[model samples]
Target chain A: MTGAALRLDDVACVRGGRMLFRGVSLSLTSGGGAMLTGANGAGKSSLLRLCAGLLPAFSGSVVRSGGVALCDEKLALDNEAPLHRALSFWAAIDRADAAQVDAAMDAMALTPLAEVPVRMLSTGQRKRAMLARIIASGAAIWLLDEPGNGLDTVSLDLLGQAVGRHLSAGGIVVAASHQPLPIVAPVTIHLPDHQADAA
Target chain B: MRLLWLLIRRDLRLAWASGGMWLPVAFLLLVASLFPFAVGPDAALLARTGGGMLWIAALLASLLPVDRLVAPDVQAGVLDQLAARGIGEEWIVLARLLAHWIGFGPPLMLATVPAATLLKLDAAAMARLELGLLIGTPALAALGLLVATLTAGLRSSGALAGLLALPLAVPLLIFGAGTMSDGSGAAFKFLAAASLLLVAITPFAGGAALRAGRD
Candidate 1:
């Protein structure tokens, strides 16, 4: 993960024939973190999607090296499966071993709920599960979309610690949230400043 | 290959858990039983037309699972997670095609035994029906999955999927049924060709639909 890098060169995003943002550029290498702050419909999630290579940039080049894991509103786990099995499914896909899955569960304080069915989890617990998935992914780049949503202060602190560990181990973290997160992100991109037009 | 297998396994488990794998088989048997009542229980008439009726039933049965094939996973963000892991959409779609066939094709074949008995299909007609289904179900599964992906995020996707897949499946229905009467074996060849083409193109087309829908 040491060589991981994410670079955007004057990126622009257009959705539904409306320009969301433009002239946004940022560069982050291993151990770097950036925060994206904006109101709803300001393209924060789209920017994260673009970074994960799930969506193409409307214009300008968005480049990345190393694997990416995205944590968004969607849990992406099997609803009926036990929490452990659901998390293990993704760990298997990411090619991460069982030990990493265990550690991720531990990090998010999800070990106790491992045997619980995913559908039974509350909103905050589900958010923790999503973060655990990202942690277990072993990807060099993490694109988190409003990761703090539905999280208690303790869980939020746990998320912060996890992101800290990731950066210290030479990984990149790019998170989008309107509310301030616990992680230290030296660069913040206020999307409204990059909006294509005021109108 | 391992990733494909993993995906297929997950899909199979999900289908089994949801009890969706049985729907098509049940529908096939139901159709088989209903045909006798609809046409009156004339054994000779059944022996003559039962194979064709079974073919139509199989076609309709294949559509029963279409709604579950792709929409739930797309809505659940499983596809996006797979994409983020650098897995190609083509590979994902291909894995799904295989899983859909595995869940659909074999069970439907197994159900055909009782269905054949219900329709009073003779052993010769039974053999043709089974063979046609064996070769043709892959295409049916592919068509259903392709339509599932296309209509995954839309409103009333279940009803819309049926409309979208029925017209596309006409050729399959023709060739599948033709296998019973056409002693020339040409219908089998055509059915195999259509199966091959649909199975080959579905991954690419479905992958594209998924990607386009993401936008």
Candidate 2:
């Protein structure tokens, strides 16, 4: 399966007595990319989370492809779990290939750390491990929040290549970041800067 | 049907991998043994108290594993994902309760035999002990599941879980222990009646609590 198109209608989100995003609407097609850009506190992460259904939008609706893989900056790993177990915990439900796990691990430069527990890894390494895990999730739509947070020059380029490959494979990708994103053909929707109710 | 099996197996696998299955059974045994030590070795006292003691230990042991039924997996975002997979939330709750039964309920029933011995119960009492445990442990798992789902978000949930479960569990305990005592045959009938009601309504209550957690 490649990817399904995603659509949102007037997706408004409010938090902490503040309106994060209001009357936000966007549609992303297969092989399509939308860059979510905003200064801090402008709801980039919040918007991405809403798209992933990890957080509820205060108003409006979000419809996305099933099996949406969310790769967040925090790298939600259970501390007591081994890298293999934590990575494979949910994937244990899906009958996927060992080859896909290997491909994801190699793509993210996480093969060597596969034996380490999540608590043993450094922040950057944990992030990379999470990227590999979600890649193995085989999700059609990749909602990434700060995928470029702590990556060095090389990993940033690696991430750009990953996004490119994902898009070229007819997958949908939405990335929320503050810094200049490393992708091409991305429909740049500035969160606060480009708050038009239509996209 | 395949997904249903997959879910049941997945829950079974996770329960096994967590080293969670045996802990409560062991706890029940240890708690049962302590009663003999604390009260001295009067065999008649042990015989008379055995059934009630076994029921009490089963109740406590059964509750120990309730948090494992959903909270950790929920915090990990696994349960929400399962719900999103077009698996009805009710089935998820049922699957989880079944898994809890496998992990917490059956072993509890098995432990009652040893508990009967520890409390110096005779053969007739042992049979009734088995009956009480067989019916009551499921009720325990059901009510525990309900409380566990309700208290998922609280920090001091262990206390809250006991608070929520023990009151509801009282009837099961009374009927359960009654089934084993030298009390009249009528007591055993009442135990069966209570067990039937517990089995019937627990699923509905547990499902409702699980739905609340999803929202």
Give me the candidate number with maximum lDDT. 1
lDDT of 1 by residue, A51-119 (tens): 999888889999999999999889999999999999999999888999999999999999999999999
lDDT of 2 at A15: 72
Q: Report per-candidate TM-score of chain A alone.
A: 0.98, 0.90
Alpha carbon lDDT at A93, candidate 1 = 89
Off by over 4 Å in 1: none
Q: How do the residues B1-215 of candidate 2 rate in per-residue lDDT, one tens digit apiece?
A: 55556667767877787788887888878978899899999999988887888788888887787777777766765665554444566676677767777877777778777877888899988888887677677677777778878887668788889888888888888888777754677766776677677666766776666556653
Compute the lDDT of residue A112 as modeled in candidate 1. 98
Q: How far does residue A7 in candidate 2 sit from its true spot (Å)?
A: 0.6
Error of 1 at A161 (Å): 0.5
For model 2, the chain A TM-score is: 0.90
Candidate 2 local lDDT, residue B1: 59
User: Which pairs of residues clash in candidate 2, taking residues 3 or more apart in a chain or in different chains?
Assistant: none
lDDT of 1 at A161: 99
Instruction: Kindly give the stretch of ten consecutive residues in candidate 2 chain A with the minimal lDDT sum.
Output: A190-199
Q: How much is the lDDT of residue B114 in candidate 2?
A: 82
Docking class of 1: high
Deviation in Å, model 2, residue A47 alpha carbon: 2.5
